[model samples]
Target: MRILGVYLENIRSFRKGLIVFPPRGITVIQGEVGSGKTSILMSIAYAFETPTGGRVEYADAFATPQPRHLLRTGESRGLIRVLVKQGNRLFLLERVLQREGDRVVNSGNAIYVYELLGEGGLQVKPVLKLRLSSGEYIEKLRSLLGLVEKSGRQRPEVFTNIIYSPQFNLTSILELEPSKRREVIEIALGLSRYTDFRANVSKVIDAIGEKVKGVQLELSRLEDTLRSLDKQGLQSRVKKIEEEKARVKRELEKVVSAREKAEKELEDVNNDILKVNSVIQEKRGLISRLQQENRLLRDKINAVKSKLASYTQVLGVSLDNLDEATKKVEEEIRAIQQRELGLRERLNALITREKDVIAEENRLDAEIAMLERRLGEVESDYREKEGIVKKGICPVCGQRIPHEHGLRLLAELREKAAKIKEELEEARRRRGVVREERSRLRSEIDKVQAELVDLSGTKDRVREAEKLLLELKSLMERVAEVASNEEAIKRMQQEVESLEATLREKKEKYASLKNELNRLREAERAMSNRLSELEGELRTLNDQLQKIQVLEEKLKSLRSELNKLVNSREVVKKVADMVDEVSRVLAQETFKFVSESFTTIFTMLAPDKALSIELSKDYEIRFYYATEKGRGLVVLPSGGQQSVASLALRLAVNQALRAISPRLKDSTLLLDEPTIGLSRELVARLRDLLNKLDEEQRAHIVVVTHDTDLLEAGSTRVRLVLREGATQVSYEGELDKNYRAFVESLIEKPP
Candidate 1:
């Protein structure tokens, strides 16, 4: 890609300016120090270096203290718009930076790319407009410029390090450490894949080695388990255990037969016990029936005698006088009930009187409270009015008043306050009298309640006496009916005795059978316990045998897996070795090509010095010269030679890279202040070399320098002047007609 023109606004030392480049020749930008000569180049580089967003750290192409420092003093925002040409298509790339708080930051949509189509490439069409995020916009820009790196990542280093060399950092590639220099060169030449392939193969080998170790470890563990099984004589032990299990099983069978016999015997005993229990139960039932009849007879007799005794004790009367005693108790109970009713009536009247007193007390309290509230208001008013009187003003109205009138108002307020106080005192006295009446009524109510409670106790006692008299009357009626039951009771007792004797004999027989059944059950439980022990022993032996078999199988499988891992590891190791050899050979061939190019370019630039340079496989530069003794190694004689050598190395790498990558054939080469320390002779040689490079049309070359001698070689020489704190550009060489027109149009009206 080649830069057509660059337009900048509020960018370091340039308020507003545009520089249009020649189409296909060396354009030398010459100006005084700090005259914005370098600013134009920096702006173009900055446009491509703006982080389209990621963790990529590009070289400092702008050479500013910070991004915001690129903006002019007192300016809050800066813009760099570059017009790039790739083949027949033209693109406009824009980057915007603004000052944010204490830091310089890109605008939200900081990058914009557009394609110019239609006639004269003046029609603007949107290509990419995106915020600084995941690098999509920059990737598109790189694709347009053919600047995508070999690793498939869009890197700004191609422009900053390869195509455009920053001011005062022309030898940046040479100044890098050997490894870093090699890495940059390889990436530019699209040879980074060799390095990546080596690294990936190594990682794979490491992974395989780790897998091999794991498999070996597992195999070792399996082998150890097998050895342990052998040490324990597992096969023989299993056989012995099987034999023991068989013997235990036989014992269990014998025990099972014994248990069955015992269970049969127990069953027979249980049958006998059941038969005896039936007989015992029947006899016991008969005895219970006889005993129940006799108990009813005794309870009836006892109840009649108890009633006779209670009647005599409570009423001092026998069954003949029971009616008289009952009548007397009934009369006493009625008297006590009448007294209780009178007491209750008196208590209810007292309670009613107490409630009325409480109501009167509450009313008095309300009245007293109202009077007190009125008194408070009057007092407050009196105090306020007295103050008003002292001030000779009316309290109700904000108006002036005579002293005598104010005093009269205060007197009225005092009189009202005194009346409220007197009413309050009278209501309080009434409330006190009502409270006293309430207390007296409460005391009368309590006394009446006590009398009622005492009456209730006397009534309960009279009710009990009446109940006893009724019971005595009932006993007197039943006494004659209770005929002599002595004979019947004696006969029932004898029958119950006989049945109990028979039941006792049967229970004795059942007890003997139950003891025999218990013995048999105990014997059967022992046999069942032995059988369970045998079963447990058999299960244990079988588990041991299964474990040994599983171990043996695992050992066999592990040995097979170990052999497979070993074979696979050998294959991968061979592949890794082959990859290493291939990588070394590729690097050697690439280095040989770059070295030849470097030697040719360096010889051309410093033909008189007989300097022959060699680039090691590490990309280290070695300068050698012919000598009478032999070819010898030496440091560069001067800074001018070093500059030439560095430039030559850069150009050689660029050439080698372009030869490999056809897309970079049209790439631009930007050299900023390359003649800073070069002698006049060296500068002339550099000019000739650049002119030769330009004539060959190898790449578009743009040189920025203050050396007038170098300007002679440019087909288009541009001069930059600083005036009024702004940069102005003027073309100073014979130019092509179309290019002249293009530059003129850009000056008059920039697109």
Candidate 2:
């Protein structure tokens, strides 16, 4: 897969940028430090690989960039759109990142992959659309790029380790320990399958050995158990127990029959006792009820007699003279009630008359007040006219007036005042008369109230007489009820006596039944104990018979399992030997090719320095240099040499990947700051190496660097500069003029 172009928004230091790469050539991306040159390469990788997306269990934490730092500072959202070409197909991969709480997260639904369709690749069709999780979108992209294995598992290292080498990580593989380096090389070259297979076979061998041990132990245990058991003896003992159990069972049957008879007798006795108890309880309840009734009747008779005596004393008569006394008391009550009625009527009339008087008096007072106001007005008018008369002018017209006219006005005002005074006097006299009448009515009301009070006293005496009369009537009725109560009392007493006698007879019968029940319960207990003892013996014998049968079956199963385990162990050992041989052969062949390629690349980059590297059967990398004093091992090298050696090993591994997988032959080689810590001569050699790869079309080489030496190596050269706070891009060769205006126009526009 080759990246054709990349578009970024708010990614790292870029607010808005677009980088278009040549289809197949060495493209050198040159820029100052922090000019966002590496961001363009990162954007391409980010489209198919998110820092936090996908299955992270197999991912390298240090190698992956943090999502929190991917977005531009002070930005809430970022975008990475990459257009890639594989074979004749064009795919556009996009990934979006957004701020969530305190961290940056990928927008799952915003990630998409679309196939560029139709002519000119203008029309688009979705390959992986919205609503899909970010992991799903990334996996789909990996499949499209042929970065997924046949087992439906993702091989992200193929893209990250072989296809792309991130900034400052060009020599990362060389810095790892020997074992880790071997592991990385194997995975990159697709040789880990053989190692993995050997590992699995070893595990299988160990498991088979454990199974064999377990089976052997179980077989030994079964043999020991078989030796300990004596079948003849067990059979003989079981037979003896059976005979004894049979004898006991015969006796138990006879006892059970006897126990059943006893239980039946006990149940019959219990039933009889229950019946007797029921009859006794009924008799006791009846007697209690009759006794309570008698007590209530006696209390009522006493109350009635006491009330009759009180009435005789209050009325000054005996019970025989009750009629006359009641009649006299009723007449007195009637007389008192008549007087009360007359007084109430008179009092009500007097109250009504007082109300009328008060209303009339109020009216008189209002009229008198009105007259007094009129009189005062007239006097004020007369005084005002007198002053006008002295001036000898007409007050209304403002003209001179005669003195006689003024004097006449004064006399008229005085006369009006006198008349008002007389009328006010008359009103006052009338109001006084009304007040006097009100006072007389009130006096009459008070006198009637006094009379009503006197009547109330008489009413109290009448009420007393009426109470005596009511008592006299009650005494007569009570005397008759007294005779009836005495008769009922005698009857209830006789009933109580009869119930007591019946209760005593039932209690005696209940006692006799209880004694019989206890005797039968004792006999049943004895029989039940004998039956339980026999059942226990039979249970013990049956258990022994079952145990012997189970042991025989288990012995057979153990023998079969032991034989199978022995055969499996042999087969597993053979398979392990075969896998080991294969792994050794494959490892030799793979390492041979990788070591040869490493030697060739390292020599080409450092031809003057007689340095060479060797790959051992264990995947150990050893560097050797020849001098006048024969050959010496390169124990420690300078930064430049280390970079050269690391680059050589990485390129050799890339070659191995291409040689093994046809799909990876045309994959892009992304190098970020590969010239970092390298000498001037080494940078030139690297430039030549990259150009040779491009010439042979081994891969599409894309390099991000700050070295100007690499500019000549690129067929498509691009320059990045930090402008204001964003990155700006410009091409350096044939397309410079054409893209300059377009790039400037883009930068001039708002982001």
Candidate 3:
């Protein structure tokens, strides 16, 4: 697989940029410090997997940062698009930071995979979706790129291994820790795939164990329940309950039968009693009405007798003579009433004249009092004004005054007061005359009142006489009526007494029937209670048996599950062991292939040293200095040898990982400045090694370097210049005449 180009939008120092790799030979991407050469590689890394370890890819310069700081300065969103070609197919992978709000948010964390189509048109459309949605897409991508599914594909794992190595990291794999060295070796021989395969096998084994444990627990519980079931005892109890339930049912039937019979008798008795009660109620009502009529007739007889006796005593005669006496009394009452009416009229006339005279007297008296009060007010005012004048100020006018003016004013007030006093005296004289008139009218009013009282007394006498006459007449009529109905009333009293006796007999018969009905109902209720109790007991026993039957069925199902899981556990264990053995074999084979490559490359890079690669059973890296020398680390004594050996190991690894997947197999290596930090003597040796590599063409290596001597005529150089904080990368096709001359001067070729 080869990276054709990379497009970065809102990524560190390259706001929007594209860098394409040359199609053939070694493509060198060269730049000064901080020219964003490293950032371009990082952008590619972000497109594949984010961050690429120990770096916030889009956070510092133009990237959309994470969480709160997603977008960098002036960047609201960011995108990284990497184009890679494998065989005849090209894929474009784009990772976008979809900013949703003012602040940086994770709305843009989606990745879209596109396939480039239509010849060299560069038109691409989405083929897949990835990023936070699921990890399956990432696994698919790794497979397409010919990478180990679970390998942490760092820069060193792919590009930096043989193609692009930033400064300071150009060392042999042998100098790395044992684990890291092992990782490189294993990747080289495609053993990482087997390692992942082994891990999956182990996971299967764990899952089987967990299922086995759950099944075992259920089996144990089932066994415990089976042991505790007491089947024989349960059977015995069921039989007993069955027998008892049958007996209860039989007894319930008998009781229910008895209850039904008693209820029928109670119903018959209740009907009989209801009829008796209805007839009794009608007779009782008739008796109550007759008794009420007899009581009223007796009361009338006593009232008539009382009035007859009163009239007899008042006139000393029986009520039969009361009509003649009443007529005589009525005539007397009319004559007396006429005389009393005339006296009342005369008294009323005198009273009306007296009221008029008294009203006039009261009016004259009020006017006199008002006149006197006014005169007194004027006198008080005159006195107050006299004092004010003495103080040299008129009180009424609120003015200062001299003594002569004060005296004049006081004299005028005195004269006005005297005139008011004269008027007050005249009002008093008139009031006294009116008071005399009122006294005369009062005496006349008392005489009239006396006459009225006399007439009223006469009227009361007439009223009493009239009332006496009416009573006498009423008593005479009632007495006559009583005389005529005495026999009939006596007959009604006797009939009432007979009805009461009949009502009493009927009520007694109703009571007797009601008692019998109550007795029958009580017996029926007792039987019903007995039946309910028996039925309840039977239902309870049946419920218990049903629950036990359900539990028995569940136990059988649990045992079946236990049998299946136990079989699965055994089979899974065997598979786990087999996978382990396979992983070991693969690891050994991979170590051998990589060991041979490491030794051959190290010898080529440092011919004088002649080192050999060694591998321990645990895959630890070591170098045998010579066939005669003892076992040691794969590290070399010289920095140049160490750098060459590490490069060889990394190349071997990248080659293996790339070749493992059919689609991504390629012979491309991106190596950064390996000539850095080396002495001129060492650099010359590195140059010699590069010349041999160019001749061999075993791999296509893209070097990013300031080592001008490494550039050659056939090399396609991607020159990067620092422009406005961004690295402006130009491919060979776009390199200008003067720029090419400038680059050529800096590149030192092996003569």
Candidate 4:
């Protein structure tokens, strides 16, 4: 359960480095100011466990106006790889940082997680791509580290605090409340069954208490609501309404009969009107088509008149005029050929551009799909956090926060998902705009195609005109201008005659509509009179039915409220029974076991012979000296003895913990400056303490000391030197000479 080596990249004071440990002995990390000795432990903790306070060292590298940072300056990403030998197996736990361009955005670190086997093992695989899995990866790491919670106190916090203690934690822990102190004690001693079981039972009691209060409040409100309605009076009224309902239905049937007779008479009249209207509609359609044909004839007449005027300009010109006309027609044919060629080229170009637009549209659709999936995952994570909070636990710390604070954390999770949804919406809108642009592009391409067709027809007409002009030059006749003009006038008069006939038919359709309108008016007036009478009576009946329905709903709600009261009473009783059972178990078995263990540990840790700890069945702790009993060392005047006693208690706790979990073989004990406040004379005692620690070979002690006097004679010391803005580690005690020996042992025993 000790870290063999820690590899850090882009961490504070060290761009890339490793701090290696001896297989199973004390390895002290000593360094000057700014040498990153603390960073090594931090990196190890960060790699394998969740370290919460602020960001990691040099984290201001991912600075925004917002209070979020993930990396250090000059670092785009960071890595902390912790390699450990748990029992007989070597494993590595890696944590990675991700950055977006320059800034880190999201709630918490986007843990790039992986599980890797060492030089002698299998595959290296990442458990998390962008976010953590439930507990699978954590369980894998804990198993390798032997972090099984046989007692709940042996959880991450217990071992982590022992292995990575800073100066402030010691004093802060001493001043904590009794319950919190008890939590630390149980965890440190590996006797967490009572504490953990009690906490869980307390949570259940609290949760059920809250439910009972809410349920009782709702019952009170339901009773008040029930009182507001007259249930007995409403029941009597219901019978009267039912009788009246039948009488009204009978009277309504008679009115319905009168309405039906009137409807039949009206139907006969309506049929007659429909026949007339049908003929009118048909005549109108024919008139509309004839009007359009007349317009075409008028346009043709005007065009002929214009052509006749042009011919008048060529009076008496014969062969010379024919030659000019032939040349002009040829010129027109060449221009048409050039215009059509340009138009066809434009049509082809537009078609190609339209295809590009369609491709863009498809790309937008794919991008939108990806964004939606991303949003779904974010929303799913948010939902999971909400559930965790409802179960009375903090999502971030894995501890239970206050009820109100947990809800606030739930809101934060939801907001993160909302931000993802906002991004998804933005992508979808862009995709929508692209789709509309694609549609418009398709329409433009269609127009270009239609224009190409029209131009081809124009080109053919120009070529025919050129041939006609050539024929005219070969045979010319001396035509009279007056006669040509007279022929044009005759064609116009025939067009006028056709228009007049179509106008006459439209007038007949208008006359038929007028007659049908008169007949409809007469029949509609008589039927509407009877319809109104029946509708008035029906409205009255409906109003009464609605009133009766409102009362019936009120009665139903009161009955539902009565049922809820019964259910709530049963729930309160059941919850009370559970609370009593758990209390009884704690009072009987767990309390006696912890009381015995606490007294034994207290005796070993205290400096004075008179000091001892006492515990009640309720788990209340009282400390005593030779003459008096106090709550803790707070009443003691001597700081030196207090430090010694605290250390003893801490060691005894760890030893008891070690006895429980064999996997914690040679478990680590980290001290920032545990010898602080000790007298000059006590320096020898401290040295004796270190020597005694090695003699027991019970745990590995790593002390970071500013005082050079603290180092032991034979223990390994890792001197951390800061030079050229980087921290380097130097130690000359051991390498893996036993690597081959250990591997052979594996073949022999195969564990």
> In candidate 1, which residue ranges exceed 4 Å CA deviation?
50-65, 86-91, 108-127, 134-161, 208-582, 625-632, 732-751
RMSD of 3: 23.4
For model 4, the local distance difference test gives 0.57
How accurate locally, in lDDT, is each candidate?
A: 0.71, 0.71, 0.60, 0.57
Winner on lDDT between 2 and 3 is 2
Q: Estimate each model's TM-score.
A: 0.48, 0.48, 0.50, 0.41
The residue pairs that clash in candidate 4, if any, are none
lDDT (tens digit, per residue) of candidate 3 on 558-597? 6777677678778877876887788887666666665676
Hey, what RMSD does candidate 4 come out at? 25.3
Better of 1 and 3 by lDDT: 1
Query: Cα deviation of 173 in candidate 3 (Å)?
Result: 2.6
Compare candidates 2 and 3 on TM-score and give the better one: 3
- Give per-candidate clash totals: 0, 1, 23, 0
Q: What is residue 522's positional error in candidate 3, in angstroms?
A: 6.9
Report clash pairs, candidate 1.
Answer: none
Strongest candidate by TM-score = 3
Residue 521, model 2, lDDT? 60
What lDDT does model 1 reach? 0.71
Instruction: Give the residue spans of candidate 4 off by over 4 A.
Output: 1-15, 20-35, 41-108, 115-122, 131-164, 177-525, 532-554, 580-611, 614-637, 648-670, 675-726, 730-751
